[model samples]
Target: MALKMARDDLTEFLAAEFPQVAQDFVIEDVAENRIRVRLATQDRHLRPGGTVSGPSMFALADVGVYLAILAMIGPKALAVTTNCSIDFMRKPAAGADLIAECRLLKLGRVLAVGEVLMMSEGGDAPVARASLTYSIPPE
Candidate 1:
């Protein structure tokens, strides 16, 4: 499918609609069937053991898929997550940026489904995997 929004467009949309997290994440790349994003690791994202927290990883996955959907459907602020399933497979490296690769599985009028694989900045193996469903708002 053709893309409806590019990285700069999404960045502006997020800045206007979700200002709270606008500075935390960046849209790295957007393609026909894939998207790559990175989280600007911060102290608050760290756990007691100096690793990225689970919630942080989950957030990355969720937003990554959401952005991928919006990239196909255009900016829809009301598009909200309805369900998510995340699996933590390995420990993320401390002080390393986290990258999320997302692909859309299905995109319909009312719902969208996608998957994300998250890995450390320079790692080969995914540290976590997630599937997310979002409720697309009416036009």
Candidate 2:
């Protein structure tokens, strides 16, 4: 399906609705069945070993899929995460921005399923993979 919420629409919606975290993420690309999200890396997102923290990666995965769902379903603020599973594969480069490519596998009335693959900017291999499910609120 085509995106109801494009990059600019999603960005503005997040800015207006989730001002708290609006600056942390950027909607890099949005298209039919796909979305690319970036976590604007900062010192606070780095771990002790100078690698991107797990929590930061998780945030990217969560929001990536969340925005993807919103793209298909429009700005549904009530849709909330129901489950998530992530695997941290390789260490993320500390100085590089992290990118998440998300694809919606299913978009049903009550539930949505999607997966995200995260990698460091300019890197070839994936640093983490995540699967997420969101519960779409009733109308």
Candidate 3:
């Protein structure tokens, strides 16, 4: 499917609609039914054990799937997540960025579902995995 929003467009949309977190999340790439995003590592994201925090990883998965939907459906800021399930499989490397690879599994008139695999930047194994479903607001 042709992309409804490009990477730059999604970046700008995120910055405008979600200014507080815009800087931390970067739209790394966009592809058919998929999106790759990075969470720039920051001190605030650490959990004291020299590991990335759970909330931080959850945000990464949430935003990654959100943007993946927008990349295909256009920037619908009102689209809200209705369900999310995340698993923390391993400790993410401290002081390194986290990358989330999101794949949209289903998209319909009012709901979208996707999964995200998050890994430490330059690492081989995934630190977390998440499945999310979003409710697309009516037009």
Candidate 4:
């Protein structure tokens, strides 16, 4: 399917609608059914061991899928997550940003399903993987 939003458009939309977390995520790339996002790791995102926290990784997956859906379906800020299953496979690298590669697995009128694989920057192995289902609001 054709893309409804580009990287810049998604960035602006995120800033306008979700100002609270807008600064934490960077839209790295946007394609048809995929989007890459980076979580700018900060001290607040670190755990006691100085690694990125699970909640922070989960946020990256969540935002990545949300933006991927919006890119396909236009600026539907009301598209909300209906279900999510995330696996924390390994520890994230210290002092490195987390990258989430998200892809839309299925898109229908009422729902969208997607998966996100997260890895620490410069790391080859995945740190986490997530499958999510989002409920698209009626137009």
Position 4, candidate 1: lDDT:
93
Top lDDT hit: 4
CA lDDT, candidate 3, residue 123: 98
Off by over 4 Å in 4: none
lDDT tens per residue, model 4, 1-139: 8999999999999999999999999999999999999999999999998999989988999999999999999999889998999999999999799999999999999999999999999999999999999999998
lDDT tens per residue, model 3, 1-139: 7899999999999999999999999888999799999999899999997788999999999999999999999978899999999989999988889999999999888999999999999999999999999999988
* lDDT of candidate model 2 versus the reference: 0.93
Clashes of each: 0, 0, 0, 0
Q: Write the per-residue lDDT of candidate 1 for residues 7-118, one digit (tens) a residue.
A: 9998898789889988989999999757998999999899998889999998899889888988899998889999999999999998788999999999999999999999
lDDT for each candidate structure: 0.91, 0.93, 0.93, 0.95
- On the 0 to 100 scale, the lDDT of residue 19 in model 4 is 99
Please list the residue runs of candidate 3 whose C-alpha ends up more than 4 Å from where it truly belongs after superposition.
none
TM-score against truth, every candidate: 0.97, 0.97, 0.98, 0.98
List candidate 2 segments past 4 Å from native.
none
